[model samples]
Target: MRVPGSPRWAYGTFAWLVFFVVSHVVAVFFPGEDPTGDGPWDLRAYVIFNLVLILMSAVGAAVVVATVRPWGRRVPRWVLLTPLWLGSALLVVRGVPGMVENLLMATGIRRGGFVGAQDISTAELWAGLGINTYFFLGAVLLAMTTVSYVRRSRRDAHG
Candidate 1:
């Protein structure tokens, strides 16, 4: 059980995955609008994408926990850990910057043309890109993670 990094790293990664999925779901489906009254969401796309993301995150967390447990020794090491961690890492890559930008915007340190504003600044544009990039990357990672998880499971069971 002596991994290079703390178990806390794995736990924190798991938490972040969960938080990101839940936050995005809320944002997409239940966002309380800004003063301008238009919502920051697209329910149709949100439901589709979030359904995939939530499933991926759940599976990833299960794999991480199982891999670290004694009973999971029967499972191949890579099967239960690599894809899980990698998917979670990819999410981190996508999410951290967006989170930073949103935090800045929330504090008013970074203004943007959200809520139907006409002119958005360069920094705001970057922030919007960051947010979009996060979601796209998240979906890609989810698909990859699912494939890897299934492949590894099959390999471990048969080999």
Candidate 2:
């Protein structure tokens, strides 16, 4: 059962989880092919990125589950959810831009400057967009839900 006012942490966590899962699925099944001379896709780099995503996703899930634990019951709501909320927000900022860049590169829509030439594929671009959108939605929803939880906690604490 949710606390009298649990805020929206659960919702936020759920949203992010969806994003993480989708992105992971896409990355794993259909790794984007970058044609841009800027850089080639490296298995090691992808592994590293996946690792980070997995870590964050796990943390988010843990935090959400913790809400049902005794500690979650004892701690102030805002105090409980703040870290997760902040982390989710950070992920949004970091992931969203990377996704956008990847999408652009994949679509061959990236503008050329002093560094002319791009290595991208239309298929990769579509994949990037889907991945990026997933990340963006997940991050934003997570942030919002976390903030809601924090707010509810604060309110309950004072009242």
Candidate 3:
């Protein structure tokens, strides 16, 4: 809902990313039931994979925070823009379609035929839908933060 920096968008983005990092970290260490039991990925592999995700998320949070501070001007334009655009695009691409598919299934417009769709209980589908919503939301927040960054950068450049 917030589009401007007046609401302190960068700080908020940083905080949400921190929450994401914390949640993923907990999920990695504690683990959870994977009903599908999809692959041969053992705990070690799972931990490593999740750690990589955690690291990426952490870096994103750091970028938002670092670039908002007074010292941010020293950071190159590419350093700020690259991850902001790339991460937002990636999240939108990953999230939006999955959400549509899930919505279709939920409405019974489509059924029984999508990746990981078969044999999934309604509860699981709803859970997945919720997570996809989070992804889409994260993309939006990141994009907003990017806008904030660009505006600040432009103002600074003009001055």
Q: Indicate which candidate wins on lDDT.
A: 3
User: How do the candidates rank by TM-score, highest first?
Assistant: 3, 2, 1
In candidate 2, which residue ranges exceed 4 Å CA deviation?
1-9, 18-52, 65-71, 76-79, 95-119
Determine which window of 10 residues in candidate 1 has minimal summed lDDT.
1-10
Tens digits of per-residue lDDT for model 3 on 1-159? 545654277777788789889988998867878722678777778888878989999999878887688777789877988998887787778667767776777777664325645677878777777777777777777888888888778777889
Listing every candidate in turn, what is its Cα RMSD in Å to the true structure after a full C-alpha superposition? Answer: 8.5, 6.3, 2.8
The digit string of per-residue lDDT tens for model 1 on 1-159 reads 222322434454455567776776676567454422354756565567767877777777676555435576587766765776577567666656656655655556655523434367777667686765665555444544445445545555689
The collision pairs in model 1 are none
- Which candidate wins on TM-score? 3
- All models: lDDT? 0.58, 0.62, 0.77
| Candidate 1, position 92, lDDT | 64
What is the Cα-based lDDT of residue 86 in candidate 1?
Answer: 72
Ranking by lDDT: 3, 2, 1
Instruction: In angstroms, give how far residue 110 of model 1 lies from its true place.
Output: 10
TM-score of each: 0.48, 0.59, 0.83
TM-score of 2: 0.59
- Model 2, position 99, has a per-residue lDDT of 66
Pairs of colliding residues, candidate 3: none
